[model samples]
Target: MSNKKMSGFTIVELLVVLSVIALLLSIITPRYFGKIKEGQEVVLKQNLATIRHAIDQYYSDQGMYPTNLNSLKEKRYLRDIPEDPIMKNQEWQIIKAPNEVGVYDVKSRSNEISSNNNMYSEW
Candidate 1:
């Protein structure tokens, strides 16, 4: 009878591999989520711009701001209200120009601070 050692990973080797994976995940997870958040912020800004432009076009043609965002959609100035990427909804902070009766501008309603240290609501 001949005795031979089995070729396999030791318990210590498995633990070391798991530890390395965990370390890598710890380093990568935060950055990944942060990048995602930044992308969402960018999308929010673009959505605001698109909505603003639609309002401008509506005014240019109709001679007054749309009464509401849905009016833009009804008039075909926009296919739809752009979603607020950060807030994950179409709810927006509609701004009327100082006593104007209709929306003159729009902003994000997100309370989360952006990477630039500005509150999303300020954008």
Candidate 2:
């Protein structure tokens, strides 16, 4: 047999490729996660708006806010309680009206600060 060496990538070549891939991932991963966070924030805002609108509509029709979020759903004012995207849970921080008899407003259960540098609950 001839003494020619086999042609293949060396260990250095493999390491270089791996490092390039890692660098790309390091550069890309944070931006991707940031975008995901932004999307979730948008969804959270929309859900909050929808729920607030439902509460207002319920108040207009019934002359008072519902006893709970589920009451809105029960009365068909809302199809269902919207999930809090930031909190990643269905739980909402229910705000009571002046009389403390029914919901006056809602907020996210998450205490995490948003990209806007405000608490998610304050949103």
Global lDDT for candidate 1? 0.88
**Model 2 misses residue 24 by how many Å?**
0.4
Query: Candidate 1 on 6-121: residue-level lDDT in tens?
Result: 78999999999999999999999999998999899878878888999999998899888778899999989999899998888999998886666788888888888889998999
Candidate 2 residue lDDT tens string, 4-64: 9889999999999999999999999999999999999999999999999999999999998
Residue range with the least summed lDDT across 10 consecutive positions in model 1:
94-103
Each prediction's number of clashing residue pairs: 0, 0
Candidate 2 Cα outliers beyond 4 Å, as residue runs: 1-5
Task: Indicate the TM-score of model 1.
Answer: 0.92
List candidate 1 segments past 4 Å from native: none
Model 2 lowest lDDT segment of ten: 80-89
TM-scores of the models, in the given order? 0.92, 0.92
Deviation of model 2 at 59, angstroms:
0.8
